[model samples]
Target: MLNSNMLRKLDMQDLMVFVAVYEQSSVTEVSEALCVSQSTVSYCLKKLRTSFENELFVNTRSGMLPTSKATAMYPHILSILKIINTCHSGIPAFDPTQKEITFNVCAPEYFELLILPKLVKRFIGSRFPVIINITKFHRDIPADELMEGRFDLVICFGPNFHRGVKGLRSQVLLEDELVCVVDKNFTLAEEAFSLETFVACQHVFPTPWTSDTNMIDGWLARQGYNRQIVARANSYVAALNMIAGTDFILTLPRRIQALTCDENTFSHRRPPAGLPNFTLDMMWSEKPSQDSANSWFREQIIKVCAEDGLL
Candidate 1:
């Protein structure tokens, strides 16, 4: 029964109130959910009723029951609200194959070895025409850089995020336990490396270029157990090289060492007790949450990780 002029006068807020009231059947409940005043909810209901020329609902003992007219028109209004939501969320006709986009991501060498291959394959097979630029993880880079749009996203381990940063979000992409990597020829490779031996052996530590110590070193310091660090390397590969055919052993994430190390030259075992497991997390700015292309990209990453049992 709505006129063309009345329909033109309606807004999304009005439809929202109508839907809320229809579903909740109470003006007070609608106000509480929408964070509006009861009068505002009542006013919207009055306006909607006037436009439709029907008393949309009738208060009954059971609830605020919808009248026949409101009941008949409910499904149509629901569909319209859904369409409005889709439009507000992002572009209506987003096509990844036809549209070109470039996303910037910062990650460490381990991510490049394990995650990038699957992500790249997905985009290429779909002909997404998208570009992903990945850079090394740097401690000097502030974690809030993602929120500032310096990069679309970042993947790193145990990100030391600054407190009080707003509009930042993160999700853990993969979890892996710590493992000890040593040359196959190392004497301990033939038998279990005990906690005492772990503390006594010469260690090839992989410290970040910006820091003097790594996670294992920090944990060891807390427990008053210090391993002998005979050498320090910036990356896992460098640390592995320092261990090959030597008595030195490198402790790092199991998944990365598994993918990068040659089984013939290297042997890996669960690290001695007290070593902690780590998770790789993807952090990003909240601004991209509403972007269709960015949402699609995030979904693809999550899907790939889930399918591959990375999460």
Candidate 2:
């Protein structure tokens, strides 16, 4: 149902007109905002309606109410406008005080739970409102998609880097070691726990969000060992909660344990030998990585993480 002729009929200016009308809810307002005549705004709106074969807006007591179809199109239109603005010829001047920004990032739930709260708290009274959308980390996403600006940033373990990573920019954010967390009431509280004890005890494992791959499981498999997985949870919080008043123990990043678990309720110890420390990295496509806005946000993230001793 798609053809070049039909595509030619759809104009970027008309999409802009539709976005303005949707936001301002009046043709006169759109005209004044764009420094165009009322008639021109109406003409653009008419073209948009025809191209989409829908009455995009309807007049109601509340002003111009977008129809269901127009409402669905609203976000996509705004996204296109943002892409255009970002891809402008020169280095785009970023005025944080004047423009609000939504940053798209991806990370595992473990990292999200540990980092996002602190990161968001730092921006509470910032001049610009920064909205962060954190999606699950997908290690398999193609390099071309990232280069095409599909995601503004990604944070995950350094080992997660793939062939596509060669084309992206990355920086080490933090180095974290694995730690074993057990309820304070654990019977082994006074004893030195070894690798054999760790594998024998009931283990609580939190599954990865993006893939079926479980790092704990994979590591055990590589060592020709397996933990007694008494419980499996989709999130680190749930896994941590399940350890209380039980024989189960959790093995996870030390940072998460320090941030989420109460010291009095839980006892922490360094992981048994053979477990290696992991480095978390901040990755972004080269094209937008150097942009002023992206650079500013990256700095903000770095600052917060450092304050928490996560760096």
127: Cα error in model 2, Å: 3.1
The segments of candidate 2 whose C-alpha lies over 4 angstroms from its true place after superposition are: 1-93, 139-145, 160-164, 190-192
What is candidate 2's lDDT per residue for 1-311, written digit by digit as tens?
Answer: 65435446877788889999899998888889998898988888778887788899998877788999999999999998888886786466677677678888877786688778878877776646888998887656446656887778877775663334577888888888788888988888544467777788889887646555556666777888888888788888889899998878898787788877888888877667777677888888888877888888888888987887777
Q: On a 0 to 100 scale, what is the lDDT of residue 109 in model 2? A: 81
Deviating ranges (above 4 Å) for candidate 1: 1-84, 87-94, 159-164, 189-192, 207-209
**Model 2, C-alpha of 295: deviation from truth (Å):** 1.9
Q: RMSD of candidate 1 to the true fold? A: 10.5
| Residue-wise C-alpha lDDT for candidate 1, range 1-311, written one tens digit per residue | 64456666677788889888889998888999999999988888888887888999888877678999999988999999888777788455457877688988888777777878998998898788889898777764445667677788877776452233467687888888888888888886444567778889899887633555567877788888888989888788888888988988888787888787899999886677777777787777789766667677778889989888888
**Per-prediction TM-score, please?**
0.69, 0.65
Worst 10 residues of 2 by lDDT: 158-167
**Clash pairs, model 1 backbone:** none
